[model samples]
Target: MRFVETRWDGYGFFLDPSAYLAELPRLRGVLPPGAWAFVSEPGHYDIPRADRCVKDLELAGIHPATDKSGRLVLEFAPNRFKHESGLRISYTGVRHLSIDYEHSIDWMAVDTVLLDEILPDEDGGCVHEIALTDARITVRCRDLEAVWGGGC
Candidate 1:
């Protein structure tokens, strides 16, 4: 991953689709251990509960680049327990998107993030999952660009 510094945040970096997929294993390990409802057994959550970490990140917001066309972006901000860093994921050619939330998304602590290829090496189409404390987001898109936004 290339670390590119930004003005608002101390640092920021971009990752193309391939790089994002390659980093999934490492990103899964970076997230905190989800609730017992998630773990305690294999595939209890239906898909797969990703691994664990120390600090938890929270959902900050979701933005659309335009009204027409399938383009979207989701942002996860650090809880500040330890640091001030976050992640922003941009999706293009979004064939599908589902955001199921019991309540609002503001400050909702994220449990895990999963991005699986819809079909192995097929035009970058993927199913991106954002598992949060009170919500579950799934997006199927042709391409994904991720940005790591560091320290406030």
Candidate 2:
């Protein structure tokens, strides 16, 4: 599975559902417990759906809780990661996670460090502009359009 890390700007990221499902075991090993991992099917951004995603994650052994905003967050002790601003900050924790992207499109984001392995090239591939904020790190698949354009 491909990965990318960028500053949060209130917008989320994307992930390949197939890739994520295959990497669950490996992800479980690397991700710290209690980290908040938000999951959602593209174009279906609703609280109930998000809650359902949390339940799905639980079935896979990755337990997460929904925050007031309906975001599915993995329960864990607070931890810090280096931001583009060069300041360290505390976040929910896990760096990457899997979501059940039942839709034709797939994606997921995590609240963790922006690792070099997922950073896009200087010329720009999938990595968008970096913003220093409390937003979750968005990981998008390079092969698909991460946004919807309003259609059937």
Number of the predicted model whose TM-score against the real structure is largest: 1
- Measured by lDDT, the strongest candidate is 1
How far residue 22's Cα lies from its native spot in candidate 2, in Å, is: 0.4
Q: The CA-based lDDT of model 1 is what?
A: 0.45
RMSD of 2: 17.4
Model 2: worst 10 consecutive residues (lDDT sum): 143-152
In TM-score terms, candidate 1 sits at: 0.50
Model 2 Cα lDDT, one tens digit per residue, 120-150: 3233322211111222333322211211111
The TM-score measured for candidate 2 stands at 0.23
Q: Which stretches of candidate 1 lie over 4 Å from their true place?
A: 1-55, 102-124, 150-152
Q: At residue 56, what lDDT does model 1 achieve? A: 42
